[model samples]
Target: MTVRPPQNLSSLSPNAAVDVLAAEIRMEKAISLERTGEAAAKAVAILNALPLDDPERPRLLAETAEAVWGYFIQRELMGQSSHGAVIRDLAIPREVLVRLGVRRMP
Candidate 1:
């Protein structure tokens, strides 16, 4: 199923509108990744395109970071490179991690 943003975003609160847009963008990127095996670049591009002032930005960043981290862990369990270059390349910001309650390693 395809996901699309609300047509009347202006009718919604700013936070709600941003949340809806972020969800749609994430869904599209995930579908693209499943079809093309190119997620890191697309994910980063989508995240970077969001306005810095959008309230949903941090939530989107945290969710994307967790998804990428899980993907890397799964790949490592399958004997792929444990040190995922893509994960490193994404380099989720420490602030986002903290917001998500993910502790940084020493």
Candidate 2:
């Protein structure tokens, strides 16, 4: 069975979203290591070191990353290339974008 990531629902600040994106990168790297039977201790350690106030943040990152990486795996499974792979698949959806919450200049 393929694991899927949950869609982003709650809106957050830009900083929070960046943090989430960073963590997701880390999670994808870790998952790649795991699938190859390589120890992801370093990646896990790094993620654990992050000063994230939201405990759910890490899981969210992992799930999101896995979902993203799954696309690549699917492409390779179909014998595709860099261009053939839908890199745009990684593009963040507009709905998932959080407002910067800054006052606009006139």
Q: Pick the candidate with the highest lDDT.
A: 1
What TM-score fits each model? 0.42, 0.30
**Top TM-score hit:** 1
lDDT at position 56, candidate 1: 83
Off by over 4 Å in 1: 1-42, 88-106
For model 1 the local lDDT of residue 63 reads 61
What are the per-residue Cα lDDT tens digits for candidate 1 across 11-103? 788789889888987777566545333453455557767898999886677665655555555445445664446546656455443443353
Candidate 1: 10-residue stretch with minimal lDDT:
95-104
Determine the backbone clash count of candidate 2: 0
- For model 2 the local lDDT of residue 48 reads 46
lDDT of 2 by residue, 1-106 (tens): 9633335723766577768878987777666644532222233334445566777654644634444345445445544546222333334322212211222244
Q: Which ten residues in a row have the lowest lDDT in candidate 2?
A: 93-102
Clashing pairs in 2: none
Error of 1 at 76 (Å): 0.9
Q: Candidate 2: where is the Cα deviation over 4 Å? A: 1-54, 83-85, 92-106
